[model samples]
Target: MLTLGPERWGGGVIFDPAGYALTVSYVLLDAEIIQVALRDGRRVPATLIGLDLEPGLGVIKLEGEGPWPAAPLGDSSGVAVGDTTATVGVDADNDLVVAQGSVREVRSFAGYWEYMIDRAFIVAPYNPAFGGSPLVNVRGEVIGITSLRLGDRPVVNLAIPIEYFTATKDELISRGRVMSRRPRPWIGVYVFPGDHGVVVGGVSPVGPARQAGFRRGDTIVRINGEQVGSPEEFYRRLWQTPFGEEITLVVLRESRLHVLKVRSADRYRFFRTTGKPPE
Candidate 1:
């Protein structure tokens, strides 16, 4: 990740089953490669590991053997919605970054556990780079993996709940795969916060919507022949359709009305990470 500011790049924590070590994962905006400086002032090379896409967490491993201490993984199940939490990571120029926040909401998404927090503050006060940092409880046990901030809002960072790690640990080690749950699909694009009217901010490039000529900036007016004057009406119509079924989308774009047919793709595949596993 590119480190902002004029500060120099530095080391980060690396914990494997064997032990813990410091490695270079963050870099200055102008630096091409990251180099780790040990506690004794010796430098070493590190390699990037796989990044968990949904959670937005990335991992990297060091090359040489050295003394290192590993942090313990905590039980996320014991964490209540209002409990306090802390974040730890290295900031730009190698300084330690820490923050505190309170859990705001705890809920599930797509049958996967998740949580949100409020009043979080970070010191050394910088971005955690690419969401690989860990969020710990008061006891210093990691309960979450830092991810990206929601849109351009940096303060409201998102994290992947540790429950995903706990549930998939054995599976990750045994079969190198996590058990996946699938969502039923219906064709077409959607906009949330329906009461305010739909703003076409995104489009599935190759999904049924795109194939049907749905483009960004197209204001949806109807779904399956039903008037969709608002976001709520659009979502309601989409959900009412059967999974894997074809549907028609009629939208107003550039003052023109166009009709298109869209077929849904498997929701699970859409969220899965792409490319080869981390080295």
Candidate 2:
């Protein structure tokens, strides 16, 4: 539940006639007031409709009436690794910015913030407005949402496939999330790959891991006596365990092996859904 700042700017696409828009979920986190800037220099107030953390997408609704210009959604499943794409977004001046790039690879991506995507698009020629930008195909149909910029010299952007949103759009809009899917166990520990095992980079301030006696630079070796070699494996093991269950973790800290137990919680329950700043 870390706040990035008091105000954040990102691009979004209206996908419904009723002013419903879609953007990366990170932009909507801890948002108390939302104002959408249109191309015609008009800023319209908006409200948080819902958020789907699995796919890292968020829904918002304009506070005005009538139909809006909606972008056509494309099937991301049909997108190939070498497909061409256009990343479209707005800059700090509210001016439209578009970048042409090709999909370098389609693979799974794991983030240190306890986030993982099964199928993601890795696009080259990173766009400056990577966050919440729309990744459109040649036909101008929105296929994915650019979520992050990865790498340094050969910078690339990670786009979450759009199919994840379409599959559960209705449920997300209605219930503020997809209710059918089982919630995963989240300990809120930020980890990275290490030589011996997964290294603990940091822990969320509001997460159970903060009080679970996990120190920075602790190398996680096993979960419930099962060895974990990478961050992906650690996440898989963590999610496989039922939520609210105690998870035993063996860590190598300061040349000593220490055993720590932490109870996992649902991430959705820990985050604010009303777009109000935490008190």
Top TM-score prediction, candidate number: 2
Question: Distance (Å) between predicted and true CA of 145, model 2?
Answer: 0.3
Total colliding residue pairs, candidate 1: 2
Q: Residue by residue across 1-279, what tens digits does model 2's lDDT show?
A: 354678898998998999999999999976778999999999999999888887799999998886899999999998888999999989899988898989999999999988898999999788888889999999999999999999998888999999999999998887787879998789878999998889999887778898898888999999999999989999899899988999999999999999999999877777776453333
Give lDDT for model 2. Answer: 0.89
Where does candidate 2 have its weakest 10-residue lDDT segment? 270-279
* Global lDDT scores for all candidate models: 0.51, 0.89
Pairs that collide in candidate 1 are 8-93, 20-68
Candidate 1 local lDDT, residue 146: 58
TM-score quality measure for candidate 1: 0.58
Q: Which regions of candidate 2 fall more than 4 Å away from where they truly are?
A: 274-279
